[model samples]
Target: MTEKALTIITQREDLPQLFGKRIENQAAIEEIITKIETESRSITFDIETKEGQATCRSLAAKIASAKSTLDKAGKARKDEYTVTADLIQVDRNLVKQRLQLLQDEVRQPLTELEQREKQRQAQHETKLAALGYLDVQDHDRIGSKFIKERIAFLENTVIDDSWEEYKSQALETKDNALRILRPEFERVKQREYEQAELARLRAEQVQREQQEREERIAQEATAKANADAERQAQQIAQESERKEREAKEREARLIAEKESAELRAKQQVIDAAKRERDAIEAERLEVERLEANRQANKKHRDAIFIQAKDDLMANGIDEETAKQVIKLIHVSKVSNVTIKF
Candidate 1:
C-alpha cells in the first residue's frame, strides 16, 4: 500500500494534541515521510529503480524543510525565554550531565569551601576568646598553629635607628622578638646598675672626704702640741744655761740639756708617726678614687656595647652578627694606663 494510505502508529501522546495548527499546516511533511517509507517496501520497478530512490530522498528533504518552518513558527522560535524553557525540556539529559559536572568542578567545591570557612571561623572564635591575655604577636603565633593556613602577614615598615624600628622588626617575625628584647633587657639593667653603682661611689667619696678632714684636724692639733712642748723644753734649757754660775751648776745644766735633747728626739718620732698615718690615709683615698674611676669607665664601655648590639638586633641583624659588632666595638675602646715613680 502507498505510505500516505498507511496509518501511523506511536506509543507517545497523540500528535494532534501536541502540535495544534502547526501539525495541520505541516501535515504534508508526515504524509511524505509515510509515503517514502511505504513505497520503499514495494519493488514496483524490478531492481529497485534509482529514479524512485532519488525522488523519495528529494521528498524527504522537502518534508524536513517544511517541518523545520512549521516548528519555528509554532514553538521552536518563540521568545528567547520561552524557547530556552522548551530547549531545556529537549536537552534535559545533556543539561543535567553538564550541571552534574559543574556541581563536581565548581558548585560542589564552592559549597565545601563555604563549609570549611564556617568551621574555621568557629575554631578561630574559640581561640580568640581564649586569647584575651596574648598580644598581637602571640595571638598570631597561636593562629599559625591552629589555623589550617599559616598566618605570617605583616605590613612593611620603614626601619631606622629608633626603638620603633626594632619593635617593628620584632613584630614582623614574632618568634625572633626575643633577639630584640634580650638586648633591650640588658640595656635597661645595665643603666640601672650603673646608676646604683654611681650612687654608691658618691656616698663612699663623701665618707672618705669626711674621714680625711677629721684626720687633718687631728694631725694639726698633734703638730701644734709637739711644737709647744719642744719650745718649752728649749726655753727651760736656755734658763738652765743662764743659771749656771758654778761648775756643779754647769754640770746640772748639761744634764738638763741632755734631757731636753731626748724630749726633742721623742717629739720628732711622734711627728714622723703622724706623717706616716697621713700618708697611709692619702694612699687609701687615692686607691679608692682609682677604683671608682675604673668602675665608671667599665660601665660606660658596657653601655656602649649594649646600645650598639641592641641597635643591630632591632634592625633585624642576628645574634651572631650583633655579637661580632659588639666585640669590634668593645675592642676599639683602648684603656690608657699611666705609671709614675
Candidate 2:
C-alpha cells in the first residue's frame, strides 16, 4: 500500500479520528507525538543501516530548513520595529564631542595659573639673598648703638624682602606640597577614569551579551513553535490514516465471517443429502438379499419333491407307501442339501 501524506498544525485544537474515535485536545496529541518521536529517535539511534541513517538525516534536514525559514520571517518582522543604526551612531558622536570640549576648557586655565606662580616664586628667592648680604656688610663698621640703629634701619628697609621671603617660603612650601601630591593625585584621578571606562566597557559587553542571548532564545522559541505545529499536523494525518485502515480491516473481517458462515451452511446441506442417499442404498441392498433368499428356498423345495417321486416309481412300491417313504427320505436329506437342484 502507498503511504498517505501528513501535515501537522500547532494551533489546531481537534485531531482527526483514530479507530473511529476523535482526538479533541492538543495536549493529548502532543503527548502521543512525544512518545512517537522518542521511539523514532531510539530506533534511529540503535539502527546501523544506511537507509535508516539516510532517513534520519533527511528528517533532520527538513526540520532545519523549516527552522531557518521561521527564523528569517521572525527576523524580518523584528527589523521592522527595531531602532535604526544611523540614529545610534549620530547620538554617540554628539556625546563624545561634548565630553572632549569640557576636558579642554578645564585644562587650559589651570596650566596658565601654574606657570605664573612659578615665576613669582623665583623672584622672591633672589631678593632674600640680597638682603642677607647687605646685613652682613654693615654689622662690623659702626659702634654698638649706631650699629644697632643701622641694623634696625637695614632691617626696616628689608621688611619687604623679609615679607617677600616669608611669602616665597610659604608659596614654596605650598608648591612643594602640591608637587608631592599632584602626580599622585593625577595618577589616582587617571585610575578612577580608567576604572570608569573599564566599568562602562564591561557594562556594554554585558548588555550586548544579554541582547544576543535574548535573540537566540527568541529564535529557538519560534523554531520550537513551528516544529510543534508540524508534529501536530503529522499526528493528525497519522490518526486519520489509522482510522481508515481500521475501517477497512473491520469491513474485510465482516466479509470473511459471512463467507465462512455460508461455507459451513453449504457443508451441512451436502452432508444431509449424502446421508439420504446412503439410506436409500442400504434399503435397496436389503430388499435384494430378501428376494434372493426366498427364491433359493423355493428351488430347494421343488428339487426335493421331484427326487422323492422318482425314487417311489423305480422301487415298484404302492403309491401311498412309496409316498410315505419318500416323505421320510426327503425329510432326512433336506438337512444335508448342497445344491438347489
CA lDDT of every candidate: 0.48, 0.46
Per-residue lDDT of model 2, residues 197-261, tens digit only: 99899768756765565556556545655565556546556665779776566556555655565
Clashing pairs in 2: 7-233, 8-233, 8-234, 9-233, 10-229
Best by lDDT: 1
Candidate 1 TM-score over all chains jointly? 0.28
- What's the C-alpha lDDT at position 335 in model 1? 50
* Global fold similarity of model 2 (TM-score): 0.23
Deviation in angstroms for 247 in model 1?
Answer: 3.7
Which structure among the candidates has the greatest TM-score? 1
Q: What C-alpha lDDT, on a 0 to 100 scale, does residue 120 get in candidate 2?
A: 79
Model 2 bad stretches (over 4 Å) = 1-248, 317-323, 330-341
Can you write out model 1's per-residue Cα lDDT over 1-341, one digit (the tens) per residue? 43332222221233222332235444322433344344433423211345654444443343334334334333432333463454423333332343334223322333455587687766645533332233333332233232212221211222233323244434445434334444444555565678789989977986677667656765765676567666765665676676745545655665677567666656765676577668867977898999999989776766766677788899999867887766754566435521111
Stretch of 10 with least lDDT, candidate 1: 147-156
Clashes of each: 0, 5
